[model samples]
Target: MVRTIILALGLMLSVAAQAQEAKRADVEALLEASNMDAMIESIYAQTNKMFAGMGQQLGIKPDEQQLFDDYMNEVTSAMRKEVSWAKMKEPMVQIYLKHYSDKEIKDMLAFYQSETGQSMVKKMPAVTQDSMMLSQQMLQNFLPKIQVIAEDFNQKLQAHRQAK
Candidate 1:
């Protein structure tokens, strides 16, 4: 009788696990509708562009470009492997399920599959890139002002120390 009970419990657990897996798969489909995979891939291309500019800023020699490219490729490959859909699915599903119902998930899927949704997905990378450029420009403009403030503070500290 105990053996039969244990077997029944095992079957129940298996069914529960299958149900959880189905939910995760549903969540994954919703994420795919939003072009999550493409967004993740775009990170690699964006980083490569940033590295090219950084090389110039850091005075990296032309001869070292090949080495940088090789290393960047390997790093990007590792990141791609690490951030695969399987790894992302659990956390994303948890976040989605926490905040959304079955109806909401369906609603989101419908919206994301629409024309406006497609346009947003297509433009997101460029929008993000432009926003980053604007932020960098703003920081560049503010940096000299920050440096001047720091220099003035240092001089005041030196004068105060001498007076003491």
Candidate 2:
């Protein structure tokens, strides 16, 4: 009976593994069909634009061409290290299998291949740039307040330590 149960469990696991493999292939195809390369280009453009704007506002004028090169190089290197693309793939694949059927991802990929989708891909940089600008502004506005809080907290800590 134990041997029979073990065989049955192994079969169940094999079937589940096959299903997962199919789902993973479908998710990877969907991700690739979404024009990931173009999306990455847009992201780089957005980053450059954001940094340029921030540089102007912050009044730090380095050589533009060298700055661009260095920035892009640093970003590329960081992405290769930080993203852990293989690990990231798992959660995304799970989400796809959970929320999106293979048919849905296929349809979405089809939509992304359309003219409107292409336009969206083109225009996303500006939207992303604006968001970065907003974030920079918020950080600029909040830094002083954050510093004050930190100072206050430090004072309290010091007082507590002295009492102790």
Candidate 3:
């Protein structure tokens, strides 16, 4: 009876291990279908554009352009090394496992493998890029109001401190 119990426990452990492996595989497949590498590249591209705009606003001299470009290149290289899909894949998988059930992961995998899903994945980078630009423009438009509010708050704080 003891031997039978031990065998049954081992079988259950094996099944659980197999299920975990299957779930991990599905999660990986879903991430692949999502084109995460492209997403990362898109973020890097956007960062470059933002920094270039800042440099222009800062009035970087023509002769300094080379130095700025070189610096940007180094930043991009570091980002690629540190945040590459290969380095992030395991942690991302674990995060998915923590948040999603096995069935949900499988369902997402199926969707990402479909035609509509593929189309969305292909266009997602551009969509994100445009969204970021819109956000930046909005912020630029609103900055003067924020600055005025901040100045008013600072003056009030100074007055309160002096009163104390």
Candidate 4:
């Protein structure tokens, strides 16, 4: 009876191991269909564009612009080194596995391999960039309102403190 129990336990463990391997394989297939490298490269490209504007935003003088550019180059290089598919894949896969079932993962893989999915992947960077620009513009428009609210809050706080 003990031997039978041991054999049953061993079989269950083997099945569990195989299920994990299958899950990982599904995750990898999903990643491949999503063209993860292109996604990472798009992010880096957007970062470069953002960094290009930082000097102007900070009002850096012409004389110091070269220095700013050099610093930005170093920053970009560091980001490129850190943000590769290889570095991100394991953590991303773990997150997916935690949240998604094997069937769900397979569905995702199928969707990403579709033509519409390919188009979305191709356009995602531009969509993100435009959305970011719109968000920044909205924030700029709201800045004065935010400042007024803060000032009003401060005055009320000061009045309360004096009363206390």
* RMSD (Å) per prediction: 4.4, 5.9, 1.3, 1.6
Q: Which tens-of-lDDT digit does each residue in 29-120 have in candidate 1?
A: 87988888788777767877776677678777889888877876887778778977668877888999788876788788887889998889
**Which residue pairs show collisions in model 4?**
none
Error of 3 at 134 (Å): 0.8
- What lDDT does the true structure give each of the candidates? 0.83, 0.73, 0.90, 0.91
Please report, as a residue range, the 10-residue window in candidate 4 with the lowest summed lDDT.
117-126
Clash count, candidate 4: 0
Q: Which digits, one per residue and each the tens of the lDDT, describe model 2 over residues 46-143?
A: 66566556656666556565776576678766875665455466676778889987678777777767888767766776777788779989999999
TM-score of each: 0.69, 0.54, 0.94, 0.90
* Runs with alpha carbons beyond 4 Å of true place in candidate 4: none
Among all windows of ten consecutive residues in candidate 1, which has the lowest summed lDDT? Answer: 19-28
What is candidate 4's lDDT per residue for 66-118, written digit by digit as tens? 99999999999888888787899999999999999999998888889899988
Q: Name the lDDT of candidate 4.
A: 0.91
| Per-residue lDDT over 63-101 for candidate 3, one digit per residue giving the tens place of the 0 to 100 score | 999998898788879988998888988999999999999
